[model samples]
Target: MNFTFEVLPEERIECLRESCNKLMAFQKSVASIRPELFDTMNFETRLLPSMEKAIHNYTVVVKNNDEIIGYVYSNISPKDTYSNEFATFFDVTSVNKPYVGCLSQFYIKEGFRKYRIGSRLFSMSLDWLKEFDEIEDIFIFVSNGNSNALEFYKRKGFNISHDILDGFITVLRN
Candidate 1:
């Protein structure tokens, strides 16, 4: 199927509610270790807070005709943001910049997989993240059991940085 990609502005993020929740459910369905962790994660708890804390945000939605089948959300935020109570996503001292970029959340519906729709979204998000001069590092976190996503980010040049939350998350960095 033909697909169109659009940049979803911060104010229009409401349209992502359904897709974002679907992404959390999809991650929970695939996670083998502590999949229950996703139970508390959804549009409100996850995406909304991230958007609020971020210094800059970029979201790309892929559409099939008028229906949005996939989206990627990214942001630039203080490096300290990763060191909160939940988990330390990376080594703080390792990054010299005060802020960092993250390809925060990405998802595509099942039927739309393998169409390179994800590749385009990935590129769009990565390019947006790289646009910020203060961003010293970029990260992508893949939940345990999502090898496809892990490999996808790896192919795109992000190395496996480390695991956090008892191996539930595999952090990738560029």
Candidate 2:
């Protein structure tokens, strides 16, 4: 259960093979809870595409005994997609600005969920945003039905900035 966190460079993870396994793990995890979202996501989905594009800009990895246990892919988005949908239901009232670090993908293996790997990965994202020197804000999304994830973000001090009904997008301001 013990592990360490490492920030993987962009070049080290540009290829599909390097992070594909974890992507598959992430896909399975999302499918287990929200198949709809999972179905909409593929290798060509927004998360990976955006992550791949931002590889040179931002990326973070969680390592357990030198193995990648989880990762959070992020970049900027002018319009918060999720907000246009469920934000009203969650009573999200935050305003979206340009170039916000959009949290594209996040996942932790089943066995490693409780080991602070997720937190470490998230912290790495926050640290990157803080020092990037070009970003405006950081944003992320969570499925509405995924109570565990919602609660986890809440516990981590991430408030519901807005919700996207079409998919449920939650943003944490840092």
Candidate 3:
């Protein structure tokens, strides 16, 4: 299968709406710890606000011809940004740097999951995040029950830091 990867400009982030919504639904389906929490999560609630708050953003989309098959969203954000009204993502003070990098969101359509597309997307996102010298800590948050994603990040060099939201989310750190 011939697939193309493109870095989406912030102005065109809307191009990811459908894929983003589906990713949320997929997570909800796999969530056992608090699936209802995903009811408030979607392109608008989750990804949009994340993009707005991030200091720097990187989004890459994979296409099979014209259909978007996958996407990965990463960002550099203030370490304090992780501690907010929502459950504090991690101990902000633990990171000496003012900013941190996050592999914020990732998804590959069911049919495309076995194609190594995810590996490529992960690598691209991490490479972009690594470009920032100020970023010392990199994190990936996996919703509960998404063992495959948890293991993928682990194998790629992230370690399980802790769970938040009463075990609804697993925080992985590098």
TM-score of each: 0.98, 0.68, 0.99
Number of the top candidate by TM-score?
Answer: 3
Worst 10 residues of 1 by lDDT: 127-136
Question: What lDDT is reached at residue 100 by model 3?
Answer: 97
lDDT by residue (tens digit), candidate 2, 16-122: 34455555545455543445555555545554556544523565666667676677776654443334432442222344343456556777766878767777777
lDDT of each: 0.93, 0.58, 0.95
Task: Please tell me which predicted candidate would have the highest lDDT against the true structure.
Answer: 3
How many clashes in each structure?
0, 7, 0
lDDT of 1 by residue, 148-172 (tens): 9998888888899899989999999
Which scores better on TM-score, 2 or 3? Answer: 3
Q: Sum up the clashes in candidate 2.
A: 7
Candidate 2 accuracy as lDDT = 0.58
Q: Model 3 segments beyond 4 Å from truth? A: none
